[model samples]
Target: MSQHVLALPSPIDLAAAAFTLPLFSLVLAALIIAGTLFVPRLHNRAGGTASPTAPVTARYRPEHRALGISAIAVILVFAVENIVRGYLLNLSDIVEWWQYATPIFAAVLCLAMTLALIVLKGAHQPERPVVPTTRRTWLSFSPRAVLIGASAAFIALLGTTVAAGLASSSDDRGRFIYLEIPVPNTEIEPLRPWFYGWDFGVPVLICLAALAVVTWATLRRNAMRPYLRPETVTAERLARIQVASGAVSIATAAVLLALGGAFRFIGRSGSLSQLTIGNDDTIYDMVWKYAEFAAVARYLAPALEITGFVLLLFVAIRLLHRPTPEGHGLRPQPSAQPETVR
Candidate 1:
């Protein structure tokens, strides 16, 4: 019988774990704080009546409030779980299955929440046919404008990141490191350009498309205002949906961008280390460069996400408080009869 020996993890892997735990904790804290501030406000506003006799609005309020509460609850749970995981990682060498499954659980919750919002009752109302009119477009203080601008900025950032990666000598074809255990000899695998594009580029483009669609919907809904059902599909409802979707999209894009930037920096450092191994400057210099870049990304990514969340909250509040236009209330106006000749 041959005895088996278990090898311990590398120091570098442990160091990376320690670094990521704090970084993730900070991001989660930011998200939880933001949700705590905004979700309650949204929930409160959901209870307010848009019109005195709007039964549909009254009935829909509870569900809206529930959705807001559920979202906030999820964030709270995620934050708590993250903190616990960080603590446990420090205490024990053994990784639990739940730690690995946390992300999968979070993703499932998000998908379920999205599906609930989509299939939830009170989404549709009887369509009111009215003539559509064009309104003068103004970019100032407009949610649609903000979304469009943000989408464009994300696209631009994606392009810049791609260009940066492409121009890097380190990014030359057939240059990647793959880890192999037990076997002493292993060659570095090729990190194809498509991998970077697929990881970062696809997400940015998807978010861009989502923002574009939301912007279009906003414009269409505003232009066809008299035609949309006032009781159910109000401007405020549309704004709420947009805010939720926008927050998700913005956060996702920022995270992906940060990850892509960090990876590119690390890749460059790895390549530099390989080149400067026997030189006067050691690999630590290359590592320092990556650390500096990652530090900037750590703060910048959260700031961007928080800013987007705040902006969306502001938009949602504005839409919720917007005054109902004349003839747009729940009570239908009496149609004037043709005057008969006496």
Candidate 2:
């Protein structure tokens, strides 16, 4: 037999390891709670009031009570899950199970997108409810179709993880597979702080713009509650869902990016001493291989989750102003096309 053999993966470890739905359920909960606590804390220090007339604080009616509560609850669970995965889980477990988190991420993304859709749907509903035999209208209104597409994407991503996992995370030159991730996994020099800005530069910009829009929309809508009078539940739900879902999406995306980096790191560093996973026959054979960087991958996963939290904190501060007597917390205002105009 050749001197080199692939380390058998951890037989004890489920090849498809990851947190169960129950864990993710908790993560979503924590993030939403963190947002709730964080906003008030940020604004309490500012003291000076913000402008209510701006579109930023235009939708704060009392009627959205239920939507707001539910969104917050869901987001909180995402937060908790990320934290536990990053802080508590072992490295081997993560690599084997990273695939599972992907679905949760997709779900969060859909939630946010749906929230936006809900807003659009309501605005267009009266004028556009279709008695249509046409394709465009049919696709647009079909919730079933939307669910099917999302499910397909989820299934596709699962396939991708399997393919990637089976293949080496390294290359011919021995860099992380596919990504050319830095080798030595940690030469430290090339992985310097300056490079982070360049790598994340474009995504950062896109995320920032999205962040601004999210903040402005939430604040403006929530602030205008009184003027709007018993806020439209749909609008309020949309706003909360947008923020909550966005929070989890950021969390999941960050963690995935971290995984990409870690894999690349293993490639560059030439260190796979950690992945010793496999059955008894492969276990001994796998030991000599020494290129199992599963631990490294695990370490990187948490970083992604952390990034999610920071983003949430940043957005919350910008939008959800603290409530006080001298506060500009939430103001309600009229929509451009009033239901009844004298």
Candidate 3:
């Protein structure tokens, strides 16, 4: 079959086009915040006495809601700043060190906020039971799916970055490319598109390592905090875990999405055609032979991103838009049996 060559856009154009995902995400996050606040609360259960855990849920729910909102807000703000910085400074046309560090900074900031929210939620709560009634820990209540998925995504991002860095054949200024193709018996040569972590994975990896430490330490602190009711604390703790987990899941996935998508789109586009060797099957064959991973990444990047986002979104909404117990939907009233506690 004959190869069809197409002209690839400049670095500026490529990066500008790639900004679409972050832009869409920002808008979606804004809508999420608005919906969380403005949408009227709905009730689904019949009248029943509030559980021993109801007050804990009631007290922390708004804080978690704010956390959820703020998680997305951080993404939105960083995204805007990233876009503005790229365009105004014309950084999109060339590689720069700041490009790699900026996203990591955003993720770290989001994680810190989540930890702060957790601290704030437990500040006024009672201490843990002196006599252990249950053996439950943070791990038991944590959202395993989210934690696992985020961990996996982080590993995948690291792998791709390392692979790209190893494969890099040239670094012009700050821009790094996996390889450059030269026309047979000619002076013409072409550069491949950008991939995340190429020639700059060290700083990114360092930042990620710090994030992991912060997350572990904060969750540990959360586990040690007291509960309103030990037996009924599962729901409350799980909700708290979801708050931190959701933020983390979103942040990790967003970084992977932004960086991975940037890599794949540009690489795939460059592979499909070249300016110097238009419609030359040799060029296409060379690109495919050398950068075979792009073929798989084209699909994998988006699929992982969607999976992470959907999973996090489901759990986040579950925690944020909790179903109000029928009796608690309207207002507070003294239970008929005030002394008949759990």
Candidate 4:
């Protein structure tokens, strides 16, 4: 029997691939935010000014500053998380559960931080408005289709996690299983990669729980905050909604990418297990149909990851956009009229 030498990936390469998305997210957010600093803030039309056409001086709201700070905090925390994970990955050759959980966890953290900042922004609303206005719910500002899509994506994530847990065997840990195949007339048996299962589903589920909690709090807080005039209220809500939308988009992308990764690995394992050294081999342990299913499933991975990357870029674009002013800070002052000889 000839010795079969197989080439395998180094631990460092695998670690780098695992961390690529997270690092990309952090850098992208930072660059976009930094670029946004150059964009000038818009001012509302002046009221009771000598010139009605003149623009009012822009008032820097504390809420905007707080929101910006929170965004910065998110990327910083994620950077720290990547550093720790890289250290841990370096310490061991074995794939750990945390490695798989890292990107999804970062996505969830982003969502939570974004929502928390929105709530903080609402808290800083001025007590007195230029005109009396009724309190408005956050739902009024939110796009219903987007909310529905986000919910669906979250539910799909849960379903995928459950499927991964059920499909995974505890004995293999998180790595793909190796099966022994024998060459006839010889005592030699070769081990090859086979079925894949995820043991880190529980950690992902926990992250999802945190995400749900944060989303609930944001909605509740936004509805309870005092309202300003329709014009002011609309602009603020739009800003909040844009931020929130970006968060949701990234979260949804995370879910898709996670599902795709799980499917891809499972399919690859299944397909690789079908390798035969001789024409008549006796390693029929894997179900042919299941392997085929996984093979088909793997095709979805690239598409999912691409979609996720697009969403990340969308987040960058959203961050670069500053909200336009809908109205002046105070009611438009009456324009000076030409004094007539009386």
Candidate 5:
């Protein structure tokens, strides 16, 4: 097999062309504010009735408050780093530092948070006695529901991408190729097959699969009505957090899958073979002049992924430091035995 090389813009140039810090900042800020305001409200509204004797003072424990603040700080730091990196990318000749450090830092933070959650135990409150009731048939917020819905959506998006790739090609041989317009008046050529496979196929599958597995496991482990240990007042809160986090992750996966499909559509719809070249102007002249317009998803998808990751991290930290149960102070202490018998 012969290798066909299409001259394309440099990675730095593409990154600069695709993203700008100011616009990214505005979008990020809006999402953060919306999440801050709405997610908790949604949880509360969906949450069942509160106990009448629940204490009103210091709803959040000291550790919970500290974790919340730390989570917010991490998000702010990431935002600032992105803005600075975006600026540096615009000016610097090499973006190696930003490229290497940003994701590593983010990953480390998330990993550390996960480890902390697993190792650290929260203050345990006595569990209330379970009342015998008729078993419900459906649980909308169950792990099973989330897993099924997310898996279906992911498969649908994958199918859509395959269809779009086929539709975009001029030949019926089921090859995935797209045009590259690096410079005006240049020769028209198909993008490398390996590039397409790596860029379009690999990342989508990995992200979707990883997110699905993690979410399914987390939700299943913390089901709404698990057989609770005697001293676990925060069980309800933890369950709610798990559900909310899974919901957000599933939603994020859906958005990413939709964006992937859109990217494929854009590539397929703008195939060079579909257009006729005249004597004066070549295909490259017509296409490369407007390459930026066509490759919008190249930048948008990563942006969404970053946003999703940050949001998920926030949820994880929130779960790690969830407020202690109000009944923690009221649980009866174990009785002392008299020493006279001894």
Candidate 6:
């Protein structure tokens, strides 16, 4: 067992590339706008938690900041890598790919947060009525259905547009990788140009999941014909916010869908095994290159995806407030207290 190092190409680090503050900033701006629109409703649901830690909002707003940091991390990397490497397959300096710590970290954290949010939402049960005439507060808005629907549509359209823009770039599909694996009996099996799709998968998945929630909520709300019982509502005063939140969700899904589609086009060359260059084991040259193409998911897609992801996270946080043992379910306050009625 001998360890032999085969050399091929340089790495892609955005730090070595050109950094565009405006582009990244715009994405952040969108996230802020979207989050602002969604978080308050979440606040209402979890408002009365007995425990200070019981509130999802307590942790969520800060977590969104973390998401912003992750997006910036990717942005910085893209700037450095693309600017320095500039799509050149020089195969000399042997730059190893940058280990993306931010998104990966964000991925795990987001999962934990999302799971926590769900559990909180689920633990709630209906409150027992103390009075005869039953009444509950239904999360409501003036024109909820119409406004939310429009928002969703806008987001969807934005995603599609971005995808189209990237596709038009010189390197629309993204990057290519080549590897040299040590095979059996000293013969080397050189891997080909493949294995680097779904770079945007995390953001895409998160965004889509949020969009699904929005869709589900909208449909549920629409179905409740005459009067919406407080027990029936998952949201508290979400009608106005839903409009914006729904749009954010749709926009996220659209961008992710576009990113996936662009990757699919690049996949046309066949993802990893596109250039299977050898038969023997242990000793061959592997050439992997990151195209300096204009269409980088790290740049465009993540912004929309992450923005939507965080907003949804905020929504979930707001919707699923931490409850107390005594406050397992929310009760509609009496229409009027006994003394007041008298």
Per-prediction TM-score, please? 0.42, 0.33, 0.66, 0.60, 0.43, 0.30
Per-residue lDDT of 165 in model 2: 38
| Per-residue accuracy of model 6 over 1-342 as CA lDDT, tens digit each | 999999744445453232233234335545564555566654444244322222322323343333333334433443354345545546453323222222223333343443344334334443322232332222333245644544564455345434433332222334323222233333445433322323433344454455445444433332222212333222222322332343233333333333433333333322222333458453333332423232353354344444433444444444343445455443433442321100
Pick by TM-score: 5 or 6, better one = 5
Q: Put down candidate 1 lDDT per residue, 1-342, tens digits, no spaces.
A: 999999998999875554444344345445554565567565444323334325433543443444344344434544567578766556442223243223224433543444354344424543554322333232211355545555565564556445434433322343321111111132333222222232333343444454444444433332222323433334333434433443343333333334333343334333332323255583232222233443455445444434433433333343344335442345533552221111
After superposition, the stretches of candidate 2 with alpha carbons farther than 4 Å from their true spots are 1-56, 60-99, 102-163, 166-295, 313-342
Off by over 4 Å in 3: 1-52, 85-89, 96-104, 120-130, 133-138, 172-178, 182-197, 231-235, 265-290, 304-342
- Model 3: per-residue Cα lDDT over 1-342, one tens digit each: 999999889998875465435454444544554454454451111112122246656766665666456445544555567577756776645555444545556656666766776677667755434334455455544567767866786786677667666655555565454455444444555545454435556666666677676666556656656665544454455445645565556556555644554455435643443342556655322343444456556645544444434434443454455544653332323332111111
Candidate 5 residue spans exceeding 4 A from truth? 1-196, 224-342
lDDT of 3 at 225: 60
Deviating ranges (above 4 Å) for candidate 1: 1-53, 56-145, 168-299, 305-342
Clashing pairs in 5: none
Error of 1 at 115 (Å): 10
Better of 2 and 4 by TM-score: 4
Candidate 3 lDDT score at position 67: 48
- Score each candidate by Cα lDDT: 0.39, 0.36, 0.53, 0.50, 0.40, 0.36
Summing lDDT over every window of 10 consecutive residues in candidate 3, give the lowest-scoring window: 42-51
Model 2, span 1-342: residue lDDT tens: 669878876855542343222343235434654655557664443222342422323442221222233234434655555567767876541222332343244334433443453354334223222232222221222234423533343333333344343433333443323322233433322211111111222233343334334433433333222223223322433344333333333333333333333333333333322222345343211121323544444444444444444443433333344344445434443533232210
Candidate 4 residue pairs that clash: 47-332, 47-333, 48-333
Which residue pairs does candidate 3 place in steric collision?
none
- lDDT by residue (224-321, candidate 4, tens digit) is 55444333443444444544455556666666555555565655665443334477675544333355666666665655555555455445443533
Greater lDDT among 1 and 3 belongs to 3
Tens digit of per-residue lDDT, candidate 5, span 89-177: 46432213232123323333433343244223222332444332333222323545544554565665466445434433322343343
Q: Pick the candidate with the highest TM-score.
A: 3
